[model samples]
Target: MKIIADLHTHTIASTHAYNTILEMVHYAAQAGLKAIALTDHGRRMPGAPGDWYFQNLATVPRRLEGVLVLRGIEMNIIDYEGNTDLEENAKNLDWAVASIHGGLMDPNVKPTVELCTELWLKVAQNPMVRVIGHSGTPQFAYDYEKVIPEFGRQGKLVEINEHSFLVRKSSVPNCKKIAEVCKKYGVPIVVDSDAHFCTELGVYPNAERMLKEIDFPEELIVNGDENRLYEYLRKYTKVLEEE
Candidate 1:
């Protein structure tokens, strides 16, 4: 189960992440990846890049280091209402991954399973959202039976983020559960490194392991097939048309 493109990765523009865009692209090229997304954290996260950084992504050529570079943002989901911190200007990016981060949510709100389910359902309907990032964290488990199907209907890729195993191990059980439901519903999924550094680009051992365990259908994995990924990009984004 090899992925030709990693659709969620971070660069030094994300502050906490350690390498530059070129550096990350270099690693992707080295890994023989066909494409990679530079999805920096949105402004709501502490030290996250500002609007200018994301809005000006046009300057970063679509092709870099012999790899297709997807300019994107990992926006922070801010409330149970499913409002994200994505800047208006960054809305047109080639890709977007909306996720709940412990540090960025409303401090006053306590997330219940029902509330998280509602939030994700709303996010699923969001046209701007391309990928549902690392959902069903231990603390943010939603109603998988209901929401996963909606995600499928909305054409949102449910991410099986490899980074969760390394940094958010507590979410592993829920991640497996999400994958099971995804397979049952025949929902398309994306496997991403969610890397914070160049060295981590195209790394997906954990996500691949989980998918293999459940015998998840390979054709349903967008990043696993280059032509399928290009078709998806051309369908929902201006990527191919940009030429």
Candidate 2:
């Protein structure tokens, strides 16, 4: 399946990430992608951009270098209760990806299957969440059978993050299992670069191989087709409202 849009990525504003927003968008355009989401890290992440950075995202044009730019934030999930470090001006953004990052969670809230499952269930119900970003980390594994369906029911796209293969190697096996469970439940998903640098933008060889090995259905991947992605954004996000 061809992913016409990459729905998760990072820029220099995220500190550890190495590219600027325009650089990332330019790479997407050159890669022939129809769209890309510039999702910088949330405030709680060490060195993450200030609140003004997200609030001022309105100044970014909806389209850049012929590629649709989704103004988004990767809000860190901070507790077992599914609370996120969501900015107060979240309404100003076009997309939000809820993720559990190491070291950002509450110290008292341990990672148990039940707790993680509950966390994801609550995240699924959050109106601000569009993507359930990279939930297959071994430390934060949830009940795939229960939560995958709930994610679909809530219109949240489960992510198959390519970056995990590089940085979170131990999670790869679980990620494949998660994808298999998603396929079994007919849960729609998105494959993202989760790119921290310009060169990583729109790159998905590892993700594609895994999905193909599982014989994943093309239609169930929301960003696999340009129209399918546009349809989703129109329904769940205001990004297309002015287009």
Candidate 3:
């Protein structure tokens, strides 16, 4: 299968990431990507953009240098209850991806897995959320069985983050488990670079290899087709409007 879109990525606005918006666009074009999302870190992160950045996203064109540009944010799940730091502003963006960062989840907390999973489902069910980024990361041990079906029912995409696999080796088994649950539930998965620099944008060969190794269904991966993604985005936009 041929995948053309990378839906999870960061820009200079994210403190730890390295690259400007223009640089990201240029690299994505060079990489032959049809579309990409600018999912910079949420406000809770040290170098994340301010409220003004999200509010003025309209200034950035929907397409840049022959590639579709999706204005988005990777919001932090602020609590086990699934409340996000930028919940109020999420509605305005083209796409909003909810994720678990260091501050939002306490690994030592009792019932960490159960609570985190419950919260993930809550966030997935929220009308404003289009995707759940890096749900497989071991640091936040969400209940895969419950979360996968919840995402399927809500038409939300579960991300298979490329960087997470290399950066968090301990989470490999958890990621495989999540993928298995998604397959059983018929939930679609989105493979993303989760790249923080121009060099990393649109790089999904590692994820592709992993999925192939597991004999994953091509139909469940959204990055394989641009038209399908446009349809998905339309539904996502509708959800945002309703919110």
Candidate 4:
């Protein structure tokens, strides 16, 4: 299953990420990708960009290097109540990926399976949240059976983050479990490189292998084909409309 677009990539704007937007887009063009999203981290994460950074995304063209460039942000889910660190300026972005990152939440507040489940359910209802980033982290594990279907109903694309396999090795097992439940519920999913560098863009070997193992339906993968990717953008975002 080849993905024509990668909807979760990072750039130098994210600090920890190494390449610039032009570098990333140039790589995508060379890779023959039809689209890519520049989803920098929200302010809550250490060294993450500030409000003006997101508010000024309009300056970035909708298309770069003949590839669709989605102005996006990966906001941290800060609490069990589903509150995220997304700034008001983020409303102008073309996409938003919400995820629970370790150390971003309160230290004293423990996360229970029930609380995690509730948290994701609430996030699923958020209109601005289009992608659910790496929900397989063991520490933030939630009810896959209950939450996957809700995500499908709310039109949220569950992400199969390739970076997790390399960085958060422990989440592999849970990630597989999440993929299984997603297949059972026919929930749409997105495979992303979650790349921190230009060369990493559009790379999805591990995630693709995992999904193929479970025979996950390719049609349900939003970025698996160009037609599917465009359909999703047209239906759920103003990216195409503005273009």
Candidate that scores best on lDDT: 4
Question: What digit string (tens of lDDT, one per residue) describes model 2 on residues 80-147?
Answer: 89999987876678899999997988777679999999999999999999999988899998999999
lDDT of each: 0.90, 0.91, 0.82, 0.92
Off by over 4 Å in 4: none
* Clashing residue pairs found in predicted model 4: none
Candidate 1 lDDT:
0.90
Better of 2 and 3 by lDDT: 2
TM-scores of the candidates are: 0.98, 0.98, 0.93, 0.99
Candidate 4 lDDT by residue in tens digits, 118-214: 9999999999999999999999999999999999999999999999999999999999999999899899999999999988888888998999899
lDDT for model 2 comes to: 0.91
Expressed as tens digits, the lDDT of each residue in 35-150 for candidate 1 is 99888999988899889999999898999877999889998999998999997898779899999998777778888889999999899978999999999588888999999999
Q: Mark the regions of model 1 whose C-alpha exceeds 4 Å error after superposition.
A: none
The digit string of per-residue lDDT tens for model 3 on 1-243 reads 777888889988887888988999999999999988999888887778898888788788887898888889998888778888775755678888888876655556654788877888789778777888887766678778877888988988988888887786777777778888888888999988889888987777767787887888988887888777877877657422432
Q: Mark the 10 consecutive residues where model 4 has the least summed lDDT.
A: 85-94
